[model samples]
Target: MTLRNQVLIWIAFFIVLMLALWIFRGILLPFVVGATLAYLLNPLVNQLQKWRFSRGWATAVVLLSVVAIILGLFFMLVPLAGQQVGGLIQRLPGYASDLQELARRWAPELNAWLGPEQAARLEATISDLLGRIVGFAGGITGEILASGWGVITTIGIVVFTPVVAFYILLDWEGMVRGVNNLLPVQYKDEIRGILAEIDSSMAGVIRGQGSVILILAVFYATALSLAGLNFGLAIGLIGGLFSFVPYVGFAIGFLLSMGVAIVQFWPNWWMVAVIFAIYMVGQFLEGNILYPKLVGSSININPVWLMFALLAFSLLFGFVGLLLAVPLAAIGGVLVRYGVRKYKASALYLGENGDKGGDQTAV
Candidate 1:
């Protein structure tokens, strides 16, 4: 095919793929989840195959192990998380009142520093902002928990996803070969290189960072709860979950922990110090150990771009979009970089002179 024809064909293919995704979005969740699980677990299956096990046995073993782990965690942690969530919601009003009381105590110092009018305004602003924040937090939390439970209770996901994932895992190599066979001969190598890059990015983000998030979540929740910090479990889980975005998780957890610590343990000073110490340790492990060991330099995506992709995808496709956002973002990032490289090498970018110096300058 002519280059233009090839380009048009690919464009049409993408459009149709997107249309299909949109048209069948409601039923795509289980499939997407299954596919993601398969992707993450494929390496384990591969390892087992390397050990001379059949693919089917390897897949079954891996899937069964994962299911056991998930069920164990669900049974152990879900009840506590649920109770904590309920308690947090129920205490929102009391927390608000406490915050306002804390603010009232600061009124004297504020008045002395900035005079009555400004302090009054500042205090009112703080109170209003606090109320708004608390209200929003409560509402969003309830909705999120409800939606999450609804998804968990979904019969299709519970029943069908395993079958989908099992077959996909069993035939993973064959599927890969099939796709490889379809690639145009002329562009096969280049396309394969791009796919490899995408694979690396996806693996780093999903498997590596996923490990990081899970470890951090467990560490934070356990440590904070042990430290007796109010709402520690919730704060830790949130912080750990946000850790995928770099410093965001730390910042959020720190702020929430500190706020709660101050509110709950103001005069103790030492306990507050202890909370700070726990986060410092967690940060140290994440920065020095977990990220270095697991993630390394494989993920080249910018945090800003990742966040934008998440927001955009979530808005466009809801929960399914959220599940797809990171993988798609990785693919998008690889393609964009490839396009840029191609653009820089083209005569159009090189100009009539075909200056190599321009390429260096572009770099």
Candidate 2:
């Protein structure tokens, strides 16, 4: 095909692909989860294959290993986590009371500024919010489970994700080669370069950042549990997971843990201080040591831009968009850089009549 025809065909194909994705967006969740699962497990499968195992067997081994680890966690931590969740829900009224009392401590100052009537209304509003927040999570979950179909869909997605992952992992190489072979000859190299960039960015987030998250989770969880904090494991895990978002996770975890501490251990300032110090040290280690050694410059994304992408995508496509935000942002960053480079070297940039070569050579 001619170069112009090839370019046009590629554009048409892209349009079709995007339209198809939109049409089937609602049903894409399980497949998306399965594809992500395969992507995560494929590395382990490849490693075992290199040691002389067949692809099928290697996939089986990896899947089995993953299941074993999950089962172990279930047995070891799930009960405690569940108990903690129940306890927190049950204690919501008490938390509300504590928060209200704490707010009232400052009501006198507010009364001086805004007068007693407004200050009293402000306290009432704060109390109402606290009470509502206690049921906010349960309300959402109840809504999701309100219909029988919702429960069935949830169960189906959980049950079938592994099955889809196993098949994809076994045939991963064939799938890659098939897609590569179908790429237009003119754009294949360019497309391959972009794919490689996406792979590099995903590796930092999925593997390197994943390791950092796990380390932080264990450190914080264990430390908090030792400190006798209520729901320490859950709080620590939440903090570590949030670490995936740079500074936001640590801050959330610290504030949450401290809030619980205030409710559970009020007038005991030492424990709250300890919790604060733990998160501060964790942030310091991540900034100075872990990130540079592991993730380094692999993902060329701005943290603020990433948060915006997450918010926008999640709003547009719900959970799928949220799950995809980071990857899409990374890919978007690559395309932007590509566009800027092309623009800088184009005739329009140097001026239509300017000497394209002489201007470049002078620099």
Best by lDDT: 1
* Consecutive 10-residue window with the lowest summed lDDT within model 1: 144-153
Scored by CA lDDT, what does every candidate get?
0.85, 0.78
Q: Tell me the TM-score of model 2.
A: 0.81
| TM values, all candidates | 0.90, 0.81
lDDT (10s digit) by residue, model 2, range 245-353: 7577887577667777877787788888888888888888888888887888887889999999877866666666666777778777877887788677767777676
Once superposed on the true structure, which residue ranges of model 1 sit more than 4 Å away at CA? 113-125, 142-153, 358-363
Q: Which candidate is the best by TM-score?
A: 1
